[model samples]
Target: MGKKKSKPAPLPQSLALPYTGVESHAHLDLPPFSSDIEEVLKRAKESGVRYICNVFLGHEAWKNNRHLFEQHDEVFFILGTHPSHVDQCTDAELGAMRAAFAEDSRLRGIGEIGLDYYWDHFPRENQKDIFIKQLHLAKELNTRVIIHSRDAAEDTIDVLETEGFVDYPVLWHCFGGDAELAERIVKNGWYLSIPGTVTYPKNEEAREALKVIPLDRMLIETDCPYLTPVPYRGKRNEPAYTVFTAECVAKELGIDTEELWTTCGNNAIRFFGL
Candidate 1:
């Protein structure tokens, strides 16, 4: 008999949940999706992503692509200099960022800005300086703050505490902290955003942290063009895959996916004032 043909696996279902939640953090302005942003957003919409916050890692990126948000009212922006690109930001840029925040209503928050010791490209002191400046900017504007801390949890916590911005609506984006840190973050009335990493089998730490966070304090994100969830790990991530992260978080917390979806959606809406 002739050899039988094997069928390819189907593309994972897009809208895996009933509710279209917000993609609280993403880099839609990055190069990966520069060619097909419309298609990428269309997929996100089909996958139940009602809103998206396109976080800029540096002032230049924000300047070049700020108009992208104008095409869709559902899309918003958070401006800041990421730790890795802290040196790229200048005094004039900082002033411009503040001015932009004041002028634009769609400028929802300040961040994807925090400590990242994982990469040694920029000096630690410089990163901290820029981070503190933006934190103050967030406070001055009375807007939400989205943080990015990797391998620098202690310093991140210290800066947040010392800076006295814990009272602000802060979201620890792409959180990889342990249960202990999760407790501290929630105790301070801050939020923890679960990324696609939660779906990975080896990410017990993220799942463990998720257990300690109350539903009201939990938000789901893809951190897309990166951190693609399991089953789609090797491929480039997009906002559409946020559902898979939400599903994994729901399973971890022992709740219905719909309930999880609604709670996280509400949490994003409240935190970002969307």
Candidate 2:
């Protein structure tokens, strides 16, 4: 008899939560997905990713692509100037961003705004200034904040504290900090987003950090088109790959996958007020 075809394993499922699964951070509006955004979204939906928080790099990017989000109700935005692009932003641009935040109901927070000392392309002072400005704007609008800190953890924490953002809901996206920093973040009531890098063998530090985070205070994301996880490391990442990152985090915490998924999904919803 001919060999029979085998069915693929079922995708892991999470308990019914307010959200379908959440991609806490991504750049879906980038050029990488411009040609096939619909297919990308379809893959995300099939993988159970119902909500995505897209971070806008700058005012021009937001203005040109904000309409793309309007077509997808599940997609949300975090409008702000990324630290790497701080040099390009001007006072007028910042004012426009403030106005957009006030007018756009889809903007859940101000974010992907923080220190990135790894790249010396722009002066550190400029990055900090823009970051603090956005933090103030977030406070003014009563919105949540998403932070992107790379090689500038201590500075990032200091800025947040100095700006009086400690009391507000903050999401430390793509957290690559050590266990100590993770503890400090959770202690301050901030959420740490586990990225696909956790799936990499060399990212043992991130995995250890994940162990210290309580499920309720933990979130998972692909940080798509960047930190593509294992089995797909060399390719472009998309929202659908968030499942792989979630599975890794669940394994690290020694819990069932569904529990991690539900907890993280609910965490995103509550943090973003979705």
TM-score of each model, in listed order: 0.93, 0.91
Cα distance off (Å), candidate 2, residue 239: 0.4
lDDT of 2 by residue, 1-274 (tens): 9999976433333322223589999998888898998988877877777788888887777888989877799999888888888876688987888888777888888878899998856888888888888888888888888898989999999999888877579999998878999998987779989889998998889898887888888888887789898757788998877887877888887888667877888889888889
Report the CA-based lDDT of candidate 2 relative to the real structure.
Answer: 0.83
Query: For model 1, how does the per-residue alpha-carbon lDDT over 76-161 read when each residue is reduced to its tens digit?
Result: 88888888888777888889888888788888888878999998678899899989988888888888888889899889989999
lDDT (Cα, 0-100) at 245 in candidate 2: 82
Q: How far is candidate 1 from the true structure (C-alpha RMSD, Å)?
A: 2.1
Q: Backbone clashes per model, in order?
A: 0, 0
How does each model score on lDDT? 0.85, 0.83
Which parts of model 2 have CA positions greater than 4 angstroms off? 1-19
